[model samples]
Target: MTTLHLEHASHAHIHGPACGHTQVPHGDHVDYAHDGHLHREHGGHWDECEPDGHAPHEGHDHRHGEGCGHESVLHGDHVDYLHDGHRHAPHDGHWDDH
Candidate 1:
């Protein structure tokens, strides 16, 4: 089994999204907060995601460039995500981005 360690180059704990942006995967619920990739549990085990890019919750098969979720941390000023080994802005933040 692949032992995946969940971590980051830098870890900043934000109480909530700078803006009101939020992402709730189906049944999952979330409050405004720092955005971090989640570690999903599947069949009493952890999933080994592709080394090329990120993955969603277990049981869902998604590939790079194929409807990959544009999940981001409302960087307080804008919405951005890490993809292709770099951070990118997905949208221009406004007052009512919630």
Candidate 2:
């Protein structure tokens, strides 16, 4: 068991979901940044969701920025995380594209 904290590390949208991309869904622990919130792996699966409707995590109000290239901007409940200079969204199993 590992306890990881949030950091300003950028995650390319390409490293995100595979609904329409080549990247596969996360099987191991994968931390995600969306809408100023962090959804990490807790308990047994990636059940630590942080959608806008869900309660916000304390002291979690910072974006990971564009370290992986392209910019990430907040877009309503989901985030328009960019990759390859194009806007892309991560696949949170609980929600679809909005």
Instruction: Give TM-scores for every candidate, taking all chains together and pairing residue i with residue i.
Output: 0.23, 0.24
lDDT value for model 2: 0.39
Report model 1's TM-score to 2 decimal places: 0.23
* Local distance difference test values of all predictions, in order: 0.35, 0.39
Best by TM-score: 2
Off by over 4 Å in 2: 1-66, 93-98
Model 1 over residues 1-98: C-alpha lDDT tens digits? 12344433333333233544343221232333334333233343333221233323333232323245755544455544444333343322211112
The parts of candidate 1 lying over 4 Å away from their true place are: 1-68, 90-98
Which ten-residue region of model 1 has the weakest summed lDDT?
89-98
Best-performing candidate as measured by lDDT: 2
Question: Tens-digit lDDT track for model 2 on 9-93?
Answer: 4443332454333221223434454445445544433332322333222332234345745455565465655443323454433
